[model samples]
Target: MPIFTVAIPFYNDQNYLSKAITSCLHQEFQESFEILLINDGSSDASLKIAKNFRNCFPEKIRLINLKENKGVGFVRQRAVEAAKGDYIVWADADDVQCPQRLKTIRRFFKENPDVDICLHDCYFIDKEGRPIDKQLKWPKSFEENPLYFEIKRNYFFIGFSAQRAGLNIPFRSRCRDFPEDYDFILRALFKNKKLKLIPEKLSHYRIHGKNRSNRHSYTYRATKEILEGLNLSELSKMLQNSSCLKEKEISLAICELLMTKENFKEALEKLKNGNHNCFYSNFMQGVCYFFLGNNKDSALYFDRAYSLDSTEPSVQNNLGVLKYKMGEVESAVELLKNALQNKPDYLDAQRNLKVASNGRNSLSITKKPLRLSWVY
Candidate 1:
């Protein structure tokens, strides 16, 4: 068996398929590794490109052709099941891997037998394969607990792994629009799997028009579904006791997950049960109350939250909405302006400001129950 299986899954990526395959073929590693190319019923020329590569290097490459166009979740599950290597390394069909990627990952896994997952950073490249000015890097706090960082941003690439391919396939029928990689990583983390980062830009991630993660609404819904399936309360307790996260951070994380599912009362209960008296706790409580339609308590909590951190944009925006509801137009306008000044790109604040500035007292015109910064 090969030491690594470089799994590349594609649908209609004829343009970049050859480059992606070639990058893997050009790996500097001295050990044997197989490149498993999966064709998800593509109508494009992607299949021909994959076949030509396989014919040229039959010993190093293999191809799997599905009769129907299954989504990425299904494709990934199939890849894991078919992979013959001890370690499965994922390389997107449109992305390019550095020549040293496999060598570095192999060395790490051989030295650290206890680690289940290994991740490396990537450089962002435009569709033309030219390097963009920016590279993606995980924060240092990721070393504390990868789950917390994953919740904040799905920053890591689906690169090297020592995980059992059969585990956490994320092939749920309800999670049709979910991020399969995010789901897989979260599942592994929840199982107390050890994750280590290589801190190297070992891959080139292509930013193109066909990227699925650009659909914010669909991504949000899918992420919500994934989070809902997990035992969040239990996860929160685990993080609270062992991870580097603070009490208020854990409470806010749980509240964010609950609120996204529209469980306002449950979120409020979580906040109330926690020993947190910080700004995030008060802000989340206010958001829950607002969503629950208990405007009086909502305003009370928003006021307390504002007192703790007056410059916070979410607090300002939420308070401004409450002021408009209470017929305090002038105060509402001022708070909304403050929120805009602090965060110019805040869509909720901008919308609320527009409505308030127009002398619109209608609650339907305003957006309320804005999430605090810590939630993301």
Candidate 2:
């Protein structure tokens, strides 16, 4: 058995598979590793590409060909089980590992036997496996036996060592659907696996539009699934199901995140059903209404908060500004003046008051509030 077993679950990624496979075959530690290519039901020329790898590196490459496509998670899990190396790893079929990735990951693992998993940062790449212009900083997990709950929440911090990416990056999912990588990570993490992150960017992640959307949608669906499978979910679910204020807060936060990067209509449905509101949401809703020219509805929500909370001068200031924009000068003056009285130096209130009292519509000040400003 090799010291490192690399598993890749491939589908129809013929365009970049050569780069991914060649990267592994030419690794500096090539003598000490084996590449297990799991052909998870590729309908394209991917299988043809795999056959080429086998033909060229017959001794070093192993292929698992399935007649049907499986989801990424199922294939990945199987790849792990099939691994014979001391360390098991995964790679995305289109990703490229830096020259030193294998060397660094192996060294890290040799020195830290307690670490079950280690990953490094990756630069987002184009279809050609070249680094794209943008680069993202990798997040590091906390030390001191950080809770898996916290770790899973910071999934962006996670990475699979280069060795893992070569073989297992292309996984087969039994679900006959894609988005299995998320499921694989969730399952492994939820089991309290030990994972370490290296902050250096050493891999190239490819960008494919369909892959991107499917990955995001899968993440949302899988996260919701994980929440359901959580042993501590009773507490979280209670918050979702309760009528209390904090419960409403938690419910709204999850709903909003779920809505993010998703269909807005679906998000609106969730908001309507939950009947939850926050100052920011109310503010945003009012802004949306204002843009939609639904001034009456916009003013209503603003006033609804106005009657509900008097301590938040910022909200009062917003209402004053909105009224001012709608040509209710006297009403705006009253609210703005009231905001100033409540928080004497709130800059927004002062600035809006200045613009309103000046009796002309011009570009408004676009900045955050400060505690010190004159009423002008």
Candidate 3:
């Protein structure tokens, strides 16, 4: 059996399929690796491109063709089930894996037999494959249940491994829509499996207009469904009982999950029950109140949160919104400016700043509610 199965699944990715396949063929590792090209029922030239690659490298490449456009989850499930390697390394059709990715992963897994999952850092590149200013850096270790962190922000990448791909096969059905990768990480961590982070940048994640993550509304809905389906309270209880996480961390994670479902009151209640009195707790309480239209209490908690961590951009942005609502436009503007000064790319802060600077008249033109940053 091969040491690695590089699984590449595509649907209408005609423009980039060949580049992805070529990168796999150029792996620096000497050990045998197979490339599984899954054609997810694309009507474009993507199938033809895959055929050309398979024809050229008949011994190392296997093609799986589907007749209809099954979603990413279905195709991923198929890939995992059909993988014949000791480790399944995922590679998106639009992304490029580094030449050393396979070599590094193979060495690490062989040396650390206990790790069940492994992920590496990646550079965020534009559609033209030029490295963008942004990059992803995952924590080398976890202070709490890794599931909590995964829920807050997805540090997991497509170019990672599920040892033998066996752990992910059972989660096939839930992997529908945009949350397949997310669902897999959460489920694996929920099962208390060990996940390690290789600090090296092993891949390039392409950002384009057609990227799946750019679909904000659909992504939010799918994410909400997964979060709501999880027994967060149970997960929280497990960490609390084990003393694996502080009460504050557990409460914050629970509150964030509750807030995602718009259960602000429930989140506040959960926060109240815990011994959480930190910046995050205060910030979350402010967020819950802001959503519930209790600006008075919202300001109170935000003020407390600000006092604890004055530099926190979310606190600055949220507090600024509260200031604007209370007719303190100058103070609001200054707070928003501070937020922007700290995080120049803060979209919510930028939007709020525009409205705050222009006064109430712009509100009619925008017709959108003032954006507030949530504490996760």
Per-prediction TM-score, please? 0.86, 0.59, 0.83
User: Which numbered prediction scores highest in TM-score against the true structure?
Assistant: 1
| Model 3 Cα shift for residue 141 (angstroms) | 2.8
**C-alpha-based local distance difference test score of model 1:** 0.79
After aligning candidate 1 to the native by TM-score, how far in Å is the CA of 27 from where it should be? 0.6
Q: How much is the lDDT of residue 233 in candidate 2?
A: 43
For model 3, residues 154-249, the per-residue Cα lDDT tens digits are 656555554555664354445346668777778777777778767788888788899787676687678787777788767777667654666677
Give the alpha carbon lDDT tens digit for every residue of 1-376 in model 1. Answer: 8888899989999999999999999999999889999998899999999999999999999999986888787887888888998888999999989999999888888888888788877778899998787745456688678887676556545643435344543433344445877787887788887888877778888989778877766876677777777787678767887557876677677777787678889889988988578887787788888878888899999899899989988888888899889988889889988988988977778888887778776543222334333212
Q: 1 or 2: which has the higher lDDT?
A: 1
Measured with C-alpha atoms, the lDDT of residue 132 in candidate 3 is 89
- Native-referenced Cα lDDT, model 3: 0.78
Identify the runs in model 3 with alpha carbons over 4 angstroms from their true place: 123-125, 131-135, 168-177, 241-244, 273-275, 333-345, 350-376
| Residue pairs in candidate 3 whose N, alpha carbon or C atoms collide under 3 angstroms | none
Candidate 1 residues lying further than 4 Å off, grouped into runs, are: 151-156, 159-176, 240-243, 273-275, 307-311, 330-345, 350-376
Q: Given candidate 2, what's the lDDT at residue 68? A: 73
Off by over 4 Å in 2: 138-174, 212-215, 233-376
Clashes of each: 0, 19, 0
